[model samples]
Target: MKRIWIIGLWIGFTLLCNPIQAQVINKPIVVLDPGHGGVDSGAISINGVLEKDIVLEVGKETIRLNRELFGNSLDIQLTRYKDILFSFDL
Candidate 1:
């Protein structure tokens, strides 16, 4: 299933980049950054929930909801796909 999805993504990318395309399809790019990592977790709740974890979860859910409910209109990208601090040099 994952392989199929990857192939589909590759095909889509190729089609989008092809010079024979008739016109450009404009889609809004949305970037969600999950903050805090390494030694920092931002704020911590009484229940031991970290702000970094919360923000990551929120970012993931926002992407899912946008895709499932919004007809996949936006191009969503998540910074630092895993649990890590974001850096321009990284």
Candidate 2:
């Protein structure tokens, strides 16, 4: 009937107009690369501090802060967690 058709159209229009939120949200990924390790020391500060050590500590601190502040919502990855040389093969 014509009345049934109009009711169906009105229902469809209402559904289309309603705002819908996405069910799945992709988490953001972050890669932290601390330069230099093992025998390769990136730079030497005037105070005799190694760049590799400093960078590694900084990377760790950043991860810690993110977890503490943002509940570790991001997928964070570290290139090297300790004093070891990593090979970059392109």
Candidate 3:
């Protein structure tokens, strides 16, 4: 009937007018893991560039650039900050 049609139209209009805020993420999480550490020296280039050192440097730079470029909007985490090893027994 016309009453049912009107009710349906009213419900549709109400739903459409409301904003759908499913999820609002303020900041994203990121974990940068640089392979190899301590005694375990990873790949080495012919020019004596260590892979572990390079990856670590890259991770550091990424954090720095993210802060400088994006105003530190992301939650960045690094595994190791120095030339040391970490036990992964857990």
Candidate 4:
């Protein structure tokens, strides 16, 4: 009786945890913004490395890692992939 009860509980838990199939509509959008770019060098480290460059590099790496791990499971978008002039007045 105890074995049967445990089996029943396991089955119930499995069913509860399983993903349900829902009606397909539209997928959500994921936006990735790597802050600071162009004329805006952002912060400058003691080594003279620009914060914008570091942020961009890290962002790209993150995107790559996400792609490798999630594949098409997620929709990823980046604000800026390359360096560009952001503002002349900042």
Using lDDT as the measure, which candidate wins? 2
**What is candidate 1's local distance difference test score?**
0.81
Q: After superposition, which runs of candidate 4 have C-alpha atoms over 4 Å from their true positions?
A: 1-27, 87-90
lDDT of 2: 0.86
The worst-scoring run of ten residues by lDDT in candidate 2 lies at 18-27
lDDT of 4 at 66: 71
The candidate with the higher TM-score, 1 or 2, is 2
- Model 3 TM-score relative to the real fold: 0.67
- Encode model 3's per-residue lDDT on 1-90: one tens digit a residue: 999999999988876776442121456779989978888789999999889899899999999999899888787889998898888796
Residue lDDT tens for model 1, 6-87: 9999998998788444332476788877888656799999999998888888888889998899977787888856678866
Off by over 4 Å in 1: 1-25, 88-90
The TM-score, computed over Cα atoms with residue i paired to residue i, of candidate 1 is: 0.66
Pairs of colliding residues, candidate 3: none
Question: lDDT by residue for model 4 over 32-53, one digit each (tens)?
Answer: 7788998889999999999999
Per-residue C-alpha lDDT of model 2 across residues 1-90, encoded as one tens digit per residue? 999999999988876776341211355789999989999999999999999999999999989988899887777789999999988799
Clashing pairs in 2: none
What pairs collide in candidate 4?
A: none
Error of 4 at 66 (Å): 1.3
- How good is model 4 by TM-score? 0.60
lDDT of all predictions: 0.81, 0.86, 0.84, 0.77
TM-score of each: 0.66, 0.68, 0.67, 0.60
